[model samples]
Target: MNTEVIWTFLSTQGADFALKVLGALAAWVVGRWLIGIVVALIGRALEAGKRVDATLIQYLKSIISVLLTLVLVLAILDIFGVHTTSFAALFAGAGLAIGAAWSGMLGNFAAGVFLQVLRPYKVGDFISAAGVTGTVKELGLFATTIVTPDNVLTVVGNNKVIADTIQNYSAEPYRRVDCVAKVANSVDAQDAIARLRPAIAAIPNVRTTPAPDIEILQFTPEGPLLCVRPYTHTDHYWQVYFDTHKAIVATFGAAGYPVPETPVAHRMVAAG
Candidate 1:
């Protein structure tokens, strides 16, 4: 090409190219500032929710920032006359592959969100879930940490817990502690019942509203099983269980009733 033709092309097209580059740069600067503002607003809104947990708020902020950035990048690419629909398809394919690979992790994340929203069991609540019974120490995004009854720390996946039963002992205000005391069938039934019921009621921490029940259960191999049931606050369940049994032994001993020398399985709860 001749020098004049080259000069003419540069003067027209080069100036337009430089203006477009400047415009894209300006858009980038404004877009980044807008993203920051939007992210801050979103964080404040989430904080205002009060129910939204801190961990979840942070995760949402990250997601919003990434989405806004992707949109901004696409806008800039459009300004430069580049194809963006192909990028969207590429991202969709990549996302599908990642989702398939991390399906378990995704399930855990969704379960965590549901847990926070539902508030089924909170920290310090005693819960039995997925065959592990313990006090819930912590609930995380993917798993839960519980201190077992034996004082061992157990981390269970969130997905596994909801998949099974969740029994919240702390949900109720009161719990019943049933203790069975079996003596010889020869013992006086009415007298034993009369002595046992009052003795159980007198124990401290036992609730008086429900009174107390001392009924003669069906005769067992050992003897007549007296079902001593007492009510107490849920927190004092274990304490009441132990103390009432002691009261039973003392009550029967003072009355000169024959007490077994060996450890008897008198504390068995009936399976429903």
Candidate 2:
């Protein structure tokens, strides 16, 4: 085009376009800051109520953040003269395509909603779900965060979690710590049980109401496998478990019990 035409276009449309670009950037920054504040306020309000579960609180916070962010994007688009009605139609079409692509994410989101309603497990609960055994860190809209025993942070889809069997260890007041002790075949089983009863009970955090159960579980080639089960709170399960083993060793060693050995068979061919 001619220089005069180019100069006019740059002076009018170019400046307006630059202004719109700057406005969009400013809106995005301010909108994000406002969204964060709103999400945080809602979270604080929910926590102050003291009635909502923490897991549910986190899920709600995530949902609110996403929705508010979407609103912010629409507002910024409006600044660029993109009509909200047009954007809505575009969004609806995009939603259909995105939903088809991220069907699993939508499934996880639905499962998370159901999980909040059903109240199967909550934050800080140790549970085994979807083959993951760990303490629940957070329940997000799309996934559940778990910190495993080995201290690994894992994120599993909520759909997988809800579809699988969940064992909530923290659901009950107490749980059994399973341990086994092998006694020599010649050792009197009754005496071993008698010695273990008090020793296992002496361990810290072991529940006294049900008492510890020490009994012959089964016989193996080595000896009679004594099941040493101690009941304790889930928080102290590992402590009691390890201490029970130590107690068994200390009691048996002090009593001079023979070590159980697997009898190996030897064949002789007469030197043929």
- lDDT of each residue in 1-272, candidate 2, tens digit only: 69999899889899898899999999999999988999999999978976566877887899899989989888888988888997788889999999999999899988987776677898899999999999999977678899999999999999999999999999999999999999998899889999999999899999998988899999987689999999999999998988999999999999999998766541133332
Q: TM-score of every model?
A: 0.81, 0.67
Candidate 1 local lDDT, 144-254, one digit each (tens)? 899998999999988988888899988988878988887765678678888887888888899998888888877765567888999998778888999998998988888
- Name the runs in model 2 displaced over 4 angstroms: 1-93, 264-272
Clashing residue pairs, backbone N/CA/C < 3 A, model 1: none
lDDT of each: 0.86, 0.90
Report the lDDT of model 1 for residue 99.
Answer: 100
In model 1, what lDDT does residue 209 have?
A: 84
Best by TM-score: 1
lDDT of 2 at 117: 62
